[model samples]
Target: MTKTKAAFNGKRLFIRLYCPREFKPKCVTSSVPVTRKVSNRASKRIKRLAKPMARPIRVTVRSGKWKKVSYLIKPGFRNKVSKMAGKRKRLLVVRDRIKAKKFAGRKFKGKSRTVFHKHRVVSGKAR
Candidate 1:
């Protein structure tokens, strides 16, 4: 038999926080600590707040396997991918780590560093 559930009497609270990018541009987070009360289930849900973040994000992708990727262009570069790779992909040799991260797709779950960190290699080793 299907179990009945109680009506939720949640009090919606709109909490404000700083943009996370201020500390580290391009960094995103689920949420920051806030004073408002939230349900245990909802707390697990991760969402990027519209507001700015207070600090730079210190993140790293840990994986055993990584693809050897090079910019798909010459020294001058051509396509977006190659262009992103810069001079190394063209004339000079280029080999960068491509770590995967959490897939933004709905059908799959689990983090992969290869895809998510693709730009890092071409863009130059991230600090």
Candidate 2:
């Protein structure tokens, strides 16, 4: 007969599938997927911002036990990754600035001064 079991840890959920008399049939675990939700406008803005970094540059590196091997990455891949990182950072700053503007003059629960200062600097309103 077929048997299935499920378990939930504090952080993740695991499911096991197997047949009777099987010591270790098959196990599957759930992990947080890497994803993000952004508005259409934001997506467009990101595309525009990242256009210049679409291509990546490849670099050679030594590896292996002997440490005398070299690997070549596709051209423009590294640049694209770096550009994406920068774009993400910029988007986060923009989001934070918007939140700060909306909550201006209101006291936040945690440290507000640092947030305000960052928002000021990002928005170019710093004196």
TM-score per candidate = 0.16, 0.15
**Candidate 1, position 31, lDDT:** 31
Error of 1 at 34 (Å): 6.9
Please name the candidate that would achieve the greatest TM-score relative to the true structure.
1
Specify the poorest-scoring 10-residue window by lDDT in model 2: 114-123
Off by over 4 Å in 2: 1-77, 81-102, 111-127
Model 2 per-residue lDDT tens digits across residues 1-127? 0011122222222221111111112111111111132333466766344222112212221111111111122344333222323222421111111111112334433321111101110111111
Best by lDDT: 1
Error of 1 at 116 (Å): 27
Which residue pairs show backbone clashes in model 2?
A: 55-76, 56-75, 56-76, 56-77, 57-76
What's the lDDT for candidate 2?
Answer: 0.21
Q: Please provide, for model 1 over 1-127, each residue's C-alpha lDDT reduced to its tens digit, 9 standing for 90 to 100.
A: 0011111112111121122111222222233211123332343443222111122222332333221211112222223222323344422111111222233322222322211111111332211
Q: What is the Cα-based TM-score of model 1?
A: 0.16
Query: RMSD, model 1, all Cα superposed?
Result: 22.8
